[model samples]
Target: MTETYDIILRNGRVMDPETGLDRVCDVAISAHKIARVGHFEGSAAREIDATGLIVAPGFLDLHAHGQSVAADRMQAFDGVTTTLELEVGALPVAGWYERQATLPRALNYGTAAAWIFARKVAFGAIELDADVHPIDQMGAGSEDMCWSTEAADSQQTDEIVSLVRQGLDEGAIGIGLPNGYAPGAGVKEMADICDLAFQYGTPTFTHIAYLSNIDPKSSVDSYVRLIGLAGATGAHMHICHLNSTSLMDIERVVELVSKAQEQNLPITTEAYPYGTGATVVSAGFFMEPDFVRRTGSNYSNIELIRNHHRFTGREDMRRAREASPTDLVMWHFLDVDANDEHRRLLDLSVTYPGGSIASDAMPWINEDGSIYEGLEWPLPDQLSAHPRSSGTFTRFLREHVRERRTMSLMDALAKCTILPGKVIESCAPQIAKKVRLQEGCDADIVVFDLETVTDRAEFNAMNRPSEGVRQLLVNGQFVIVDGELETGAAPGQPIRREMP
Candidate 1:
């Protein structure tokens, strides 16, 4: 009897990072699971001639923030199937999940419990609204920067913990402690957060507390504090954006992290390929008097995306931030193209053994500097965002594997797929069935021509999606086929931590 499949990918270089299986084979999908791998004489309702293409598990982004239909479509072209908001996650987890359930999504989405947002609610600084992402409302508390700069008293700390616990109880994937966003959060509070993560058997995703290259609250100092917390609480601590946060002092910072991992302290890290990072212009660190000295970059490196305006100096940057504190800005921490040293610094983080490749992708915005919430296809021409949002996975493949050969095809795929999946699978067991090309895994796959797979999105034209994805499937449904987006398909599912 011939087995039947819903879809069949024939004669593709099927690569599974988990089992190191890289060879020409057929992949059969049926009922949202990979039905078979190897020779398939079976007929399918839809058949894709995948000759000369790479068939692998779709990439997983653990630090994604572009959680809209438009954003997901752009990422679909880049071969991503699962995007998790593990860093700076959402408050009121159940409400956020409920809101997302009503939207049409192109890729799987999930979020962690946001410590900072919980703080805002606990301090009576902001109202709870699941529809409002933290990035959109971060500036509302910027009047005094109290949420980022004030220590919570005993009662406030209790309230904050209670709110965060409620989110966890509601099945948030983990705890998100973006310490850099709130540097004044006391060690006691952080320790409490780590303890909760340990109790829940989940990881804590963090952006370290500081970013200065020099001491007295340097990146090194921050790493030490984070390592101590992990050790003291016996919790898994995952560092976000190792490249941008380490600045020029990545060597020292990586060494400290390496030693901690050597001692088996459960410290993990992720890095994006690009040196520039996107964030709110009014970030607390940007307001520091020695911001330029600390980051080793001048005001010109901070570019407002809406008008492409580069600040001439600190005052100019301050003026723009004061006017619209929540506006998105790109911070060019390293010029990888012009400087060999800067490029090497980025490579150190990106190629770090055991580190995953995550896109800390920002949301798209309109000309008015508002987040684009409409379910528009191809995105609006005037919409702007960091190129990393759309191109991180494809760009990594083109440069690291195909072009420079800095990483092997199999290794790079692991960084994008299995490595990231394993990071969160402990808490979100549903992810265990993803990020594999084996039979019985969820049928989330990407087929692309390796030779031509590259990012089209550049700094100047940030909205362009990547090229050369022949087919993309999420849960046995095609979001993109034959290099064109299926504008009507929305097969995305929620990836949440299982509740008791």
Candidate 2:
């Protein structure tokens, strides 16, 4: 007699991105393992009639900030089971783990060290009052993001580097180079850390330094430079938010990067599916006159609807400028009509090589225990811009891949799943395994109502629950069942991707 399985999903279209095969079949799971894959006729204690739903490996978000609970919440609706926080390695690893250990999320998590964050935390001695980057004994600062000054020039950088490696070594899937936001950080700082990331074979996701600075050293130039670094170091460089910065030039930039890749440069990129891009008011776009005018968005033209930290309204934004001139803010940038350069950009990458989807949503908790609020300042448009938090995956699926037919669904899912999974596994061997589903993989899976799903959590969409997550399971426990959140469960697990 065949042993009864724990759960069986019968009569569903199995959309396997891994196999690129779509079929009407039954899928069975027992002991947290994907028990059977083909016309599986097995009895189970619990059975779901997936007649028209799509059963694929839960989607993987290549880029995320790790703040919004909805980040996990949307997983149910978006078919995402594994989500990675590639946010410039902001939080300390141990503390990050400590907090995540308690958050009520419905998924698996992995992270790399934020070299820039560590640099700033360690930058206590650097006098921000001065403009010239603090010169070190080595002089040129960390060459090629190759290294950073000790200030003491001692073992501090070594320590940070070790931590960076340790995070990956400890199971972080990849490295984050929030390089764009940290101009003071030199190339050496990047190169040194990336050397280790390369050594581990983990991909380094970078925010090209020229992202917001679309002048002098424009975003395109920064991307070219990052591509060059990827080629020189033999490091895998994954550019984040390909649509954000001067990303309107993405087509040409993609061609350039692809050309580099023809010569075998380790470069790839991803974008969040939203017209408006967000960043701190202090971001390079704000500093540049052209970017501000082109986007037709300025500090005064924008409102501070959300202040997760000390920054508040326009007055607060102004004061915060005085307070932490380097502090970050999220802003919107997109146009309904393509400018001339944008047309050229599109022509270059009519196929738009290697751009994936990601949400750079940071955890929005304040000292007073609050998530970020939209800007309150009376600006031209009080509209806040962050559709990625809820709708990135769906919009991309529904709009471009499904509606506009920009790319096939298989190509789209590859960006979310196999790509990052393969990238992370390079360093974190545990991720590159057959056991991930062989009854022993950490149970981070999301089951969704593919037929009816919605992601309408815009800043103004009063009282919205995420759309269409039928059943979400993490660590063998259901977090969302019958399209509702299971408020009383500790199914969330922090997937540390390093070695013991």
Candidate 3:
């Protein structure tokens, strides 16, 4: 007789991008693995009637930055089961992983070894603080500014490479290069990091060196350089947030990436669904005088995330940049007309073949400039954050797949799940089993009402959780049940790359 399973999801429209399975089926779970994927005669301790719901592999976010309990709760509500800080990764990778392991999390977590943080350590710009990750201390007035502004010499570069090696040895998923944040990092330094990734058979997740469309070093130039490095070193290169980085030039950027893939150089890119991009006002991105011309926007296009105040002129920008450099600001670059070229450009990135979807999520900060931590979730109304932190995946389903019909449901799910899974599995073997609904796979799943699933979080009220995600399971345990979050469930495990 078939043994009774721990849990069973019955009569759901199961979607598996990998096997191309989309049909009504019963998924049985026992312990942490999916036990079956068809009709089940045995009874279960718990059973969910999932009729008219879509059950797919939980969403995976490769560019998440909010690595806290509050952030995880928000992500779980959005149907994400795994989130990584691959863009601006962590420093002292081992410590970061250890610290997170001690906390209760609602979703799986991991990070790449951060080249920016490693460089800061080598330059003696940031001291190793066991209690705090270097990224937590980054502010305009902090010592991190030196690493972002000052070019590294040969000795310093070698030390940075050594630190990255140590992190890789400590089980980092890959290497993170936020070159745009560190403008002083030269081409040689960037190439060396790629070489390190190649040596370990891991990918380099990068926020490219330039964001502007204007020359001398345009966004196109940056992609060409990275593609060249990938071709030269055989390193898998994953570009972050193509829509924000490429702006209106995403078409040409996608063309270049496609061409590189055609030549068999392993390269991938991801984009969030929103039209606006968020970042700190004090970063090097806003320091250039040509920022207006390059981004095709002026002072009015910049709005403070904290207070929603628009930067009226150069003085307003200067005051914000100087007084509160770490404050979040939104750049309304893609918020154009519906039929405008900008919207088309944004759509192209989202619908690009095999391109993964990632949320470059920011953390929710309180009125006292503190981040919400340790199960203090459902952030207060006064706290501010980018909506992408809570809504990227849901928004993609609603706008692109449902409303515009730009992307089919299967293709969209593939982008959010299998595509990202393959990208990370190339480096982290631990995640190879995730992002697919199959027998013997980890039972990370999401059940939602397709007709009603949508993101409700807007810029001002960014903490509002997404609606219609009826249930979310991490490692076969429900973190969200019936549209409500289960605060005590901490079934999330760490995703790490095993050293060869």
Top candidate on TM-score is 1
**lDDT value for candidate 1?**
0.90
lDDT winner between candidates 2 and 3: 3
Candidates 1 and 2: which is better by TM-score?
Answer: 1
Question: Which tens-of-lDDT digit does each residue in 1-500 have in candidate 2?
Answer: 67588877778776656667778887677666677767745698988877766655665676666333544654445556666777565335555666666666566666666665555435442321111211111112222222222331335567557657656654566777776656555566667777887787778888777654334677677877787788778888877777665555665576677788788777776666555555544443344445454444555434333433433334555565444443334454444245555434432332355555666643332333233332221111222234565566665566556555777767766666666566566566554432133234444455555445556656453123456556666655666676666655545556565564
Clashing pairs in 3: none
Best by lDDT: 1
What is the RMSD, in Å, between candidate 2 and the native fold over all Cα?
Answer: 7.1
Span of 10 residues, lowest total lDDT, candidate 2: 130-139
Better of 2 and 3 by TM-score: 3
- lDDT of model 2, residue 135: 12
Each model's lDDT comes to 0.90, 0.56, 0.85
Model 1 Cα lDDT, one tens digit per residue, 252-307: 88899999999999899999999899899888898789988887888889899888
For all predictions, the C-alpha RMSD in Å is: 1.0, 7.1, 1.7
CA shift of 8, model 1, Å: 0.7
